[model samples]
Target chain A: MNAGQQTTRRLVSRTGPSICRSCLDTLSRQPYSTAAAAAIQTEPQEALPITPPTPSPSYALHAGILVSRPPLLTRPPHPFESAYHLYQKRLNERLALPFTRYFYIKKNTPGDLEWKRKIKQRLTPARDIGRYRGYGDEAWNDEVLVGAQESEMAWQVERLLEDAERDGGEEEGKKGEGVQTVGGPKKLEREPVERPMPRVTEADEKGDVRSLGRLLQRSLYLVVKNKEGEWVFPQDRLIGKESLHNAAERVLVQSGGYNMNTWVVGNVPVGHYQHDFVPEHLAKSANPTELGLKTFFMKVRIMAGQADLKSNKLGLTDFKWLAKEEVQKTVDEKYWRSIKNMLAER
Target chain B: MALRELPSRAASAVLHNSRPAVLALRPSGRRNASSEALRDVESSSSFEVPFVSDSLVKAFDPIERSKRRRLGKKPLPPSRYQFRPPKYYRGPLHPHQPPPSSDPVSREFIPGPFASPRLEQTYQSTIASDLMTLTYHHLPPGYRAPVQLQRLREWTGDSPYFKGRPLRPPRGGGGLRLLDPPRNFKNIPEITKVVVHSMVPEAQDNSAHLHVAGMIVQAITNVRAVTHKARHNVVGWGLREGKYVSVTADVEREDTFHFLSKLIDVVLPRIKEWKGVAGTTGDSSGNITFGLTPDVVAMFPEIEVNYDSYPPKMIPGCHITIQTTATNDRDARFLLQSVGLPFYGKLVD
Candidate 1:
């Protein structure tokens, strides 16, 4: 026999010890038996061609009692597990840390004033009254005298001039006699004046007037009034599992209707404020929980999309770009004091 | 008598002023002549009338003269003075006064009973509120919205702003397009090493048990297993320092891949009751460790075929640690998954 046939015969003898020479001879007589046909039918269509007939009598023994079968059974299907399971397991096994909330205290730009002006003009025109006043004709009129007695002295000089012109010859003769009586030669000599009087031009005669006073502008803080009518800055809670800066940006988008891609958010917090109280919505719920809410206020500059303030889902009832004084009047005293410096002009 | 002397004083002033005028009228006159004439006129004055010339006044009081000059030549009203508002006045004045409340008061101030419900409904019906409801109600609980899903919503014009900009097509005619091949495969995963470890109890410190465990690891991994001594004493468990407590084998490169494939395809399935590896088996450094029973370890063809070579003693369970070239457990798990290993839990953020 060839090496391949000899090796197969040895493996078959080792695998199926119970199969007799007569059974093997009978199987050789009919290489394709009813049992083989049944096995082929039961096997998967693609696997049938790849799998050679089993050397053991497991398939043939079921049809004829010429050989015994081994006790080993076929293996079950094993499917590959998913990666999501590992992620969840790791998450559950992780240690918990304390919750932190971050808030953004955004700065208003010069365009904010223009926005406020436009809003005021459209919604409430009365509030658009100018914040400036002209100093009036009195401030503009620059003809005030330096001293109270200077005007009277000037008038007396003018009168003296008129009298001198009327009686020139007689007055000159008297003045000459008086001059001869009191140290004549020394009195005749004159010294140069130390200072000269400034001449007045036509422009000076008209007056050195000042222009009108400038408008008194004030810095506007972005304030929002909740459904309960309490005025507060645009803020929201920071959910767990995110960096403070990222949470702050999300809060701006979710609560302030800010677009993150368009807005330039500051990496560090400008200031921080904390308070212990239950939120209005939470307080109204069946279970009220008081929380020590800490907020790290970051600064954000809006680059686009300011007109859609009404698009925020937080249910704020009113929004106003108010000055520091106005915001103080509207919000709680303690809350205002905590964030007063942040709202001040930088 | 002093009143009678006033006429002589006026005449001397006029004569002094006239000499300068005559000097000014004659352009050709030498400066020395005018200066001499001025000195003579000043010396001739006998009556000392308290009247100071403008030049003398300027010399003595320059600041006052400049102030008057800046104020212009016209005489000013006596009553003019700098205005200073009273310290107590806090309210606005003139242009600063609050604008007349021309706009109607907001209906929010009125009692809820008197307010219009229709107006309130219209106010509440915003796109953001709708989106919030959709996200909360439509999506599965704890399911993070994937980036692609969010981008899909934005591209479909569901977002109020399209990618934070107004929803407008480019001037050149192209519209928003989806990113090609949704997955980013820049971070490819690779198998780093495979470690097989078996812990033997101190009570079972017999050489036969240790030898059998080492042989099993060596046979399955085709690598030599190293026996590790216990570092600390555990009185309750009867473990002592310097005792052989464990045997471990590390397989790398081609061997790691071969061992992993063999374990997944041949050994793992043969276990009587297998439910895949635990998801929490991985460490932070992307190495995943799992345990297999002695029966499962024996199921390896290497151990199964030559069952008689080793003594038929109870074999100890062993742990298989698969390390990957990944930064974290998530990426390691993904790599393992790609290589046909199954994991069982949801990924957290």
Candidate 2:
């Protein structure tokens, strides 16, 4: 074996078995159930129809149509398979929103409608499936998340089913003296306990939310402070990349919209190291009140081209904030106690 | 814009590389008479008044160069348009038929818009050359220079708030009562009036350290006057002669606040006629002097002056010092002068 392999083996041998405790527990319980579960997910394997069913007369004119079925996209092989591939390629190109000139769909067939109704019936309680979904995967990937995998027809049916279930649950709870929490239970705590959970939306998978979130994060709210105090606004922070998606649903709303934003000016970026004397000098030279209130601004050019943005490229100019409330909160007693013991060792 | 008007006087001055002191003495006005007529204004060599010709002024624009290129021939009399010196003076209009003016400044420089007869009539009395010079230098100062402009915001919005509370009264009272109080200096008077001055190296090459040392000597000596005035009005006796002193550390950077504090404490009590400086207006030189006793400097370990060093030294004292490595002497001069320094015999007045 290679030296690296030998070293890894030796380490494993010294540490005992390499199997994860949880994985081992899963394996010991039964491997068959997981396989059966995987096999039971039949929605993805079913090929789309040559033409999607047209909407029923009622749906066709429905002004409240929250969901609409797109036309069936086919990639079928043919006698002239190569030509068919080329045609498929052209059709795929037409699928692009920017270049597509027209789009039409045949809606509403009975069999498809039944499948939608069945999928809709399965959704309940809106449980967080983010951890199981995997990063960058849409919240509603067909094989990944059942709650998000339902078709448009199924979605409407699902909403009706959920309303019925909620009403039924409330009635049952009323019989049992009036208390039924949505996601199981909650514990009483003094300070509001904020649980960071990823929220998956049906629109995120095979829909526009993820892409739209990316555009907004890059263009507008590029610089932001996270829980770790790092100034970064990844699209992942908006739509989420990993299975832990829907940061906006959790932290953003919980934080009461007090999020700070930044803009670049001059050569000085925000958070660039500055001495106390800068304020004194500005107070003497520029407007003293601005200096005292920390309102001096600078404009600077980005040193790196925008192309390297995917590689964590930083511009020459940076925007730093000395946000008053945030800084005060940072030095507060409770916040200090939270990190003090461990930081003291460092 | 006309060729003659296209290049700013600053650019011409830069091209000519005239010394600032020399240029300060000259009076260069603008040109006059709109170029639309191509018929008005006389070109006379008799008086070297140097009013730019309407034709010569038309050629200097960068945008016009593209138009001249499209015409398949270079414009004649390129000297006025280019940065080079003119070999000869031509007539009022160039030999070639001048193209129509599409320049932005051409219309703006004149009183009225293009093709208007009133344009020439309105501006005929004033020379155009003077107006160009006026516009060039009249750019708003502070973060608006070509180099710094890119970084400035479109607008700073509003003026910063200033706290205009009356400055604290000078610590010691003036005249006899301040120096020898009715109860004989009962309350140790606070040294309030501090006079801060800066010292520069006689030569540009002098070490910043040595220069600051010299400045400290001067500031201390000058401060002595304020101190003497505070206590007993002893003319110049606050410092007993022959005690030479120097600061080991260079504090040229902190002189303003540091000296101000020192004046409030150390130098005030030693003055004989120690009345506070609140009601006092102009000193003999019309410049205010502040004094602090050495005791205050004793409170701060940063200062090196000794209160017990009774007799002040004969060594030349120091003032605040500024060090710069930039090419712009004007920027360097402005930088120091902005920090409350007296420049070109201009006082705070």
Candidate 3:
């Protein structure tokens, strides 16, 4: 019967394996099981499909947040990519049009003299654009721009400025200065100082999991260690009748504290992870009706602040803002496989 | 930032260029040279710009010199070897074939739409991936989609005309529905170009209204507005046949980005009570159109900066058409919504 069950399981596994297979059978049967099924399945498989399949095992729905900080800095290209680009640059340079210096620059003016004085007359045959110089015959050994992974936090600043401009417009309009006064939108022109934050933070150096400062060049997802000593995204069981998105909002606050400002990307769940409850754990809890857990992941972007695990009522043991690879390493193989697709590659 | 990245994308085309021109790849290229050189000497280190003083710029007049050069000289004759593309496309077998578009001198060669905008960047980085995941249909490995009936139906009951007739289109009126291909990573909806069109009815009576409209449109869009002739008389809108009724600027390439960013960032916010673009804006096909009133048009920074230059009443309202690669309105709406343009009222997706 056990071997028969395994074979039958393999047969109907495509419908919905494990706990939900029975309910899936009822759904599929109503729609009429395909001719393809009859072509593939044997007589023995058909007998077990009918009986003891309508019990309708209930699974608790969970709303989980994969709160992530998008890559703060664009990643530097690999050595090969940079080299290919360098080659392309040199190729473009070699097959280029002649520069009409006579037209653009006058013969003996200060600007013209400065152009002659400042221009580095290299032995290379090609007239170059910008500073990727190919000195002499070794022009093939060109070095392309290696965009350093530095955090200017320009996006954050731009967002703040945009928000300010938007919010301030109404007040300015009320003052009769916005549209009326030629003062024109109050320009906040700050001379951009090179106050770049170090790409590698102190948290990174100390290997501190609690800090969000580490990993500037990759998407850092929030993974919390629950009471079960398992690393998972911030998750909790859904309360009665709340929508999936709202449940996600409530779940995050319930598990983690209210210190962080988060923007949930959309109302719908990105993906879901399902696991059959362990028989032993189910026995201990004495829950005959409960079969498994299904977590619907809501993608939330953490704009500012930190997850305060200490003050949280749900009692999460620890938390880490780790990149994709680190996330895979921290979570179980099954859990990793399910949620990995939803997370950003970098 | 876009100005710095412009040159590298000169070879690329009007498409989804999310990687942000080749300048981002190199360290030296990444340095903000133009800004440092042009703005001030103290702001930058070591590198010195040539003395670009007011006197130097004032003295170095290209227009005056060009005027001087052409003062007495007759126009130069057209070069003997200069190639003009065939007026008609001869067969491929013909000896005097037209050059491919890739050729630099080809009339069809359009070098730009370079430097994909920041909005495209936002789409590529975040919105696109989010959309793909949300719309993903996970069919467990070998699960086959059930066979479905074709939308178009065959003619029945043997009418003589029906014998050789092609399959009739779906039962709806002669409206042809766009093919909604299943969403995947590769075929993500992308913004193509923006068309800024303005109707100047007063232009028929006096040409100044048309010129002012064209100038304002050109200033805001960074693309020269082309005057469009009315095909026939429309008495209601004051349009007459052969009359210069409207001017339109097709904002493609870098201008699309610039125009969109300027519209969203500068102008849209300044509006006192913008309820947003109408929800039923998009045609069933990909393109979405929204209109900006003359009052709203006044809010554009380019016009606002030089408010005294134009007559206040002459500013013409324009319809902005956002063309996207998506085949349907829903996808186009999603793309625009993700880029922070809200759509209010009954969204008919």
Candidate 4:
């Protein structure tokens, strides 16, 4: 038998000892699957055929399936581990490049192979949130963990694959620049199997990964509803009067508590209105004339009492009551004049 | 004796009067001249019979020798006091008088009511009523002082207060203190639909973009003038003419930035400058004047002016004029008086 057929037979026998396909084939032994071996032999035969199939326009349809089926699955990683996991996924998604190859390989060298095992050991379960800290802590375990668990292990694996691809790409680039192929009988020939991948600098990578969370927060607000209609925060959250003193202080805090520079607060009222605290003017028994007449008013003891009523909590601003005696002392000159003029004309 | 006394007084006067005539005669010819006139007219003794004093009477006498002189000259009359004209009165004169007003029955009087309590109260209350009921200001005095607020890293500790400070004198003393400075109105870009509307039939026109742009230019200039006077940026303004109305302002700062940026980037391109405005509502310039206060608006031919501080109704503020032209009709004359020209080109390198 030829060397190729013998090599295939040996590989097939070593690969888990399962043999169902074409047992008598000359090239069945290989590290690769039996199907792979068959495809490789069939490829050459197909390229040089004595009687080829008719060249139909429908060839495009036949080629589509072959082009789409790649070894790598591009579906995103699951996103439900933890908030940090989600954050990392989003970051990666934002930085995803359109074209480039990154892959993992088994290391056989002492320096790389041993270091890979050590790195894997370092990715243990994270015992605490803040404990895990590093540029790539999200993918690997931070200091709190010594070994990766669950999805994190997958992240580590993915990161290692990327690193390997980048290292290979760079090495290929250096080798590519130093050599050139010549077209002559005296020149040695080498097959062009692979070319160097594109370079992605750190800055360009960061730009791709950058996100704007604050911008999104400001641009859109959630609109949740119930049977009653639109939702309103409980009085405590909305007004925060009973819970706070110095109304302005409450305002400052609720408005996103001040940041180092500008307040990040939103939905602030333009000005304070007294109506929130005071009874509606229409509901009061006092005549408009009597209330209107008072020149100076004193806050009634009862008004203070009313201010505490969980139901009637004073609104945005305070309101004082006009004393009965003071209200009587006041007069509406316009009213009297209009009445007098009407009587005189009649 | 009385007659003799009269003659004595008269004779001295007569001698005094004749003194000047005697002096007038030549010293050498005086006796001859006097004798000739006296002798010709009367006896010398008769001339002498004036006062009983012989010496005085002699001064008045005419001599017989004067008769010869009389042939050439008339006799001089005896010296007498010069006739005195009547003395004039100096002080003010009074007409006939009447009795004082204390006579009661004769004096005229005006009778009416005096200081009624009701009237006084009405007046007091009217004066007490304030025109404006609401006002806002910083508290604890000098609230704008830099020391009051803590600094921020991004902030340079610059004057946020400077935004509201007046750029010029206020319209009136104790008038509307501009709490905010003038601001550019938001320019809406991509004006696919241009609508020109006016209260007056004359203002009707199809080229709304031209009218609005011209109005904006005019409004900005007017605001600049008032702003220069009041020393304020036109913080906000509303323009209304009949049913046609527009409001401009930086309601919020971030929104304002977006507005100004969009206007510069988008709306400015569509503006047509040279097109004649449609509708007769405005004069040739397309300026429609409005009032700031109700009272002020009353002065205009149109609009009802009422001075109601509560929800200020009609007040003269600024007039807006819109001038429009087609984009293809661009020329140097299309630009009106504005705070700045609407620049439409690549930013200078």
Candidate 5:
């Protein structure tokens, strides 16, 4: 027997008889063997011609290296997808749609009162008798040829009488509440009766209450009277290759007659309104697009100038510097609903 | 005083005072008084003393006495006043006195030395002829030579790509070979677009905050941003379908180049404790996506200007995806390196 087999037999006898000799012999030989001993054992084993066991298919090799191939290279779908395609899709969807450009003209409080007076005088011709005609030849010509008509003179006389009657009624009301009407010394001795004051209108309250003295009170949105006399905000068709805000500024300068240098415009739109393009007449002149017009409104603050808008020069007859309440009442329901939040009182 | 002359002076003073009273008795005094007053008033008013003083009137003595002591001194000559121009006045006093020059004087034209050396016409013509002949000979056989080149000597220029050196095609039939260093990589590869995206949790989705995020993106990129909605619902993550969970702004062309320059020159340097973008940050495609902290996003000058509008607590972190027109990550990395963005780590296979 070999040395390993003899040692295995000794170990097996020491431990127990039933233990397998081959397992013991293999463990002992593998642990104690050096490179030289391993070489010697391999030579002898080769000489004896004991065949080696075959490897499993899982551990198969070809050409002394692993036989597995790399997965076939493929392109991912994402990198080929581009933002330009998405942009084109969005553009196609919005084709043939009309866009509205909205601009707000800032108002000067003091100038607004003068503008309102001028508007009132223009509206009521009969009450503007003392209005300045002109100077020199103009005044002479106006005096001679454009004298007040009989109807206007009669209306003026009627207005004077109405004014006198109102003054007289106010005096009578004051006198009725006075001690003279009661005709008693006791009434004079007693504390003055707390007279119920007249209920003030919104205009009266605005005149009485002082604002916080902020330089800017409210911004004025440019509005033009349409042919039907309905008040509509100044709007222009958005041109190609122009942003909505830029288009609004251009429209304000060209049509609204606002100086571009004096106004400070915000970049982002404050609000937007979308309405169907349904004109009253189905004439060819009217727009016949199926899509609605989407209007983007941006806020602009006036930096300088009197904020006097020249409406007549741009084919608009009249304009008014309206407050939030007046704007709501003047604009259409759909427009008011979209812009009310932007014009809401802070 | 001479006694007699003094008596005569007193007598003359009395006579001078009495004469004016005596004259008042006649109509001449009244006429002269009215006329003198009118002339004097007009004269005085026309030449009014700007600074009037009572002391000046008391100080003046107009009449001379005939006494010996007074006779030595001649009577002060009547003070004459005439208006003259200010002492410092250098030109005409009246506005219309000096008329504007009718003729505008032309400024002399002093031409500076020629900025560059003037080469001889012969030299330029020779070079031009040589260039024409060179190009003509090098032209493909099917193309006809121009008439100017027919008069020049035959000359064929070397290939522009190889300069004067002999043409050396890439070596080893299928192996790689280095070529001349390109001045610009624009033809081979380029940045296609820069996309800025930020995801908001479903529970944290607020339209106002999202709007502010969109505004920030717009401010940073100078391009309008669009809201991205969730495509699929993940019930476990509380995500719902069609819900807005992120915003993105895709910048291209000039804006993409501008953003890249700003990221390299400004934003990246401001990031604290930053190493570099990892080499493995890109996918199989050449698009690279990297996460940025909220503070790092705020470092962009556009957002810094209007930072108050978006409070710090509301500023969310975002991911920036840089897409390049390259086939693979290695090429994309080379492109980014050319633009000054450093990459870290050895690239994984």
Candidate 6:
């Protein structure tokens, strides 16, 4: 007999001759419900080995607000990603049925005439959509194509030269000089579309860290100069019996003032930082038992308005909205190491 | 509609294709007008333009023709309006083919998402980073995970045959469940889908129960409910075999975000004495299941807006299972918690 059969026979014999093998099997399997219950759970949040409890020393609890403006714009695509996406777009366009132009543009309308004039200027297929300038390079720097609007630039330059020739020779340039050059064409009814604002704002040009407008694509965090003459997120000593989240909100309003609207993410702190007080600083305090400060950071998202530091409770000298890498350079190394993981990379 | 537009569109398409050849016949005639037109405005080339003739444009009156066709006694052929995607992918070698689903003409194409949900934006913007940071455990470079016991146990007797014999299945007659992978930037949990399922035993006698359940589910989820039949008879539950007793809907993509946000922001708060979801709801894997009572379900805008229409007695309660990308319940719970879901009781993970 096979070893498998032998084990089954021996198991049946061990159980007793009265019990059927199948019944024994089922009885053994009875408690085997969803195996999800069998899986072990390891996280013991309260039992974190990060800090060992000290029997003697009393610690000062501080609440810090990690006030941040989430990314204002999407991160630019990688070179390879843009290329792949462009290839897929082009392939889809090539295979797809032509867009029904008549559905959108009524027959013999100005819009229809304008569309006709556009396609006649170039051999553009109905399927070519958006600013699809024919797949030369899918660069995120808007280098996707050299330009479909090269002819657009040429006309502007042509008009400028025409204006110069007209004014320089005999007449002054008129603002309302209606369509009167070369083969005369009537003005179309469509409004000239406005160009999008440039990505590089004035704040970026002047290298202003205080402006929320700077670094439009990255996560900008608020860091204030503390009473210690060091840059940190605005923090304050916890009030008696105040919860961590309440303390966080209080400290944030006390330090930054109530100019901005903010929402705290949750009741539980996202992270905590602990550091020892200098001997001189502790000696100056009334309480003799206090050893060091433990700051629990609560994440607060800034929906609107800027941090106002004039009504400061913590005596902050300055404030700046800095991106992740900029925060690293501005804040001390130890502080950076402690808080870097919490910042979103954009 | 595509069929009605076909005759005019097909004729124009023919004109567009044959234009270059027409222009090639009179190259000199087309060249001079183009140069004159270019100095100020976009150069209008009559021969090159797709819609050059006003007569052609005047002839393309779909509204008038459609009216005439509708006025006719006999309707158009049944085959003209219907378009069905091929039942099977017959392979690349097959000649007769269906267009890819992404194609506009493809039958399977349902266009959207028309807009990004507010909760989806919030999660992508703020909550995602918090989850990643909170879960991250720093291990030194080149450090390996501790070895785990093999799932299949070796035979205990150490009989010579046991050495190479096929090891037995793990205890409890199941494979090791729910992988607990180390947290990193790459594996941050994001919700995949929310499934709303309602079981209506009353539906066995009256199909109206099933219909009402379906309407409520579809309204809240924005997806059609699929009816399910009981495969086996259960005497105590009064469920007979092949009985239609349940309706379910899978809320996915933008619908999932909208449903979750509506639950968190509106319906859930309205329920009095709500202690929040039980922490033991998750099934070890990243799926968390929780039930809403009939009154709580009715709290949704879909039902509350039209409460009179639904028979007051037959509103079915449903279990919502949120499926996330996380491998374990711990990460899934963290993600849901960050997205404004509250959990009470001892967390199983």
Runs of candidate 5 exceeding 4 Å displacement: A1-346, B1-187, B202-205
Q: For candidate 4, lDDT tens digit of each residue in A68-183?
A: 00111112223333334533433333233321111122246443443444344432222122223234513332222112242353544544454433322333345665464464
Which residue pairs in model 3 clash with each other?
A: A145-B25, A145-B26, A145-B27, A146-B26, A146-B27, B113-B253
**Per-residue error at B88 for model 6, in Å?**
5.4
- Which segments of candidate 2 are over 4 A away from where they belong? A1-222, A225-346, B1-306, B309-317, B329-349
| Per-residue accuracy of model 4 over B273-303 as CA lDDT, tens digit each | 5122222232332222111222322333212
lDDT of 1 by residue, B181-266 (tens): 21122333346788999998732457678888887888788676999988888998778888888899998644575677788878
- Computed on C-alpha atoms, the DockQ of candidate 4 is 0.00
Worst-scoring 10-residue span by lDDT in model 6 chain A: A34-43
lDDT of each: 0.50, 0.30, 0.71, 0.28, 0.49, 0.73
**Candidate 5 lDDT tens digits, A158-260:** 5445432332233334556654555442311223334433333354456422221121223344455645576666555566556655665665665446542
Q: What is the lDDT of candidate 1?
A: 0.50
Candidate 2 local distance difference test against the native = 0.30
Which ten contiguous residues of candidate 1 chain A have the minimum total lDDT? A62-71
- Compared with the true structure, the alpha-carbon lDDT of candidate 4 equals 0.28
Clashes of 2: 93
> Candidate 3, overall lDDT?
0.71
User: In terms of TM-score, which candidate is strongest?
Assistant: 3
lDDT of each residue in B84-109, candidate 2, tens digit only:
22334455585543222342122211
> How far out, in Å, is residue A198 in model 1?
99
- The per-model DockQ list reads 0.01, 0.01, 0.06, 0.00, 0.01, 0.04
The alpha-carbon lDDT assigned to residue B292 of candidate 5 equals 82
* Candidates sorted on TM-score, descending: 3, 6, 5, 1, 2, 4
Give the lowest summed-lDDT range of ten residues in model 6 chain B: B43-52
**Candidate 4 Cα errors over 4 Å, as ranges:** A1-218, A221-249, A254-261, A264-346, B1-349
